[model samples]
Target: MAARTRAIVPDRSAGIKPLNYNFEVKPPAFITFEGLDGCGKTTQIERLAGYLRSRGEPVMVTREPGGTGIGERIREVVLGQQPAPAAELALMCASRAQSVEEIIRPGLAAGAWVLCDRFHDATEAYQGGGRGFDREAIAALHRVLCGDLQPNLTLILDLDPRLALARARRLPAASRFEAESEVFFARVAAVYREIAAREPWRCRLIPAEGTIDEVAGRVREAVDDVD
Candidate 1:
């Protein structure tokens, strides 16, 4: 939820999946929702998107590791059972760069309330923290390549590490990130907490270890706030 303001070209919105750092914005700022693989991010995104749409607010629902045409291809490559961690993270970042440019930035610019399932913070938490990469390195990539285009609002759904992994196992395998072990996801939750602690004003943590509607209620309240 590193909110910042920057001007952009009015009609240069591209599609999702930019590998290079060359981005010219065309959308308004956005709200992003992020968490571990099965902490109800997708369900919450759908509910939030529906809620905002009902209010006549423009909303865009999207996800990372695969958002655009090219990104979906990368998604397949990155999700293999034995993909290298660096390779996986690199591909994920590649997908995100384009998603930010094409779907996120442009949608935000067009006054649509962009609601993403995951963002760069996923990179920091999973790739850096859970996977044992350097936090400074992850931050450096976002700070440099992404500039100041952080989420206007971020809802980090936190659940007990073991419980999250257990639930995740019950669901269909979504991506490479979803295949990590319980201890790995536990580490991710810890990192997410650290993130919220560091950015209290920007993040609202919800106990995502409950019924769908119950968790969704928390998600709505968090997004209903004014930044």
Candidate 2:
């Protein structure tokens, strides 16, 4: 049987009681960004991190499959060439496990807000939706690998797959995931929406068709809502 896992809540005060509160302040948050390859997740993450730092909030930025030295090598294999769905999923989980142990858990414990470009949501979308992996199995792996750690807020930049692919192509050499079929990306996007629908409070969907400044404004609103 799969072990029962803790659900990640967005609000810090969601389940706490005044009498049980031990800290003078709540711990920092773990915020994540999810989207298609070219949906501008990196841009928004940079903007939000800068804004947070400017406002005197200690923030740490990181990315999956490449957050740690070992994770980077795993990233190269996963993104450099096509692999079987199981291999892809395992590689992703390995990177995530290392990241949580090496970076994410420590960052939150030290009261620094963590802004990650991609988290397990990408696995759910790409491996689960696109590759037809079983969602229950994925959840079980996440529970074992990450324990109770999860994003406090997950902001997804939603965009038309056709446009997003076009934008992705203009970048340097495409990664294996980036080079996937448009139909596959459509599947990925659909799963992202489904996840947002399932967790409306923790996940916010932002249209990605607007200019940088315009999209940044929407991102700011979402962050403010969580903050």
Which ranges of candidate 2 are over 4 A from the true structure? Answer: 1-27
State each model's CA lDDT, in order.
Answer: 0.73, 0.81
Query: At residue 116, what lDDT does model 1 achieve?
Result: 81
Against the true structure, candidate 1 has what lDDT?
0.73
Give the TM-score (vs. native) of candidate 1.
Answer: 0.84
Cα lDDT for residue 31, candidate 2: 85
Judging by TM-score against the true structure, name the best candidate. Answer: 2
Q: Which ten residues in a row have the lowest lDDT in candidate 2?
A: 16-25
Q: For residue 18, what is the lDDT in candidate 2? A: 12
On residues 84-120, what C-alpha lDDT tens digit does candidate 2 reach at each position?
8899999999999999999999998899989998998
**Total clashing residue pairs per candidate?**
10, 0
How high is each candidate's TM-score? 0.84, 0.87
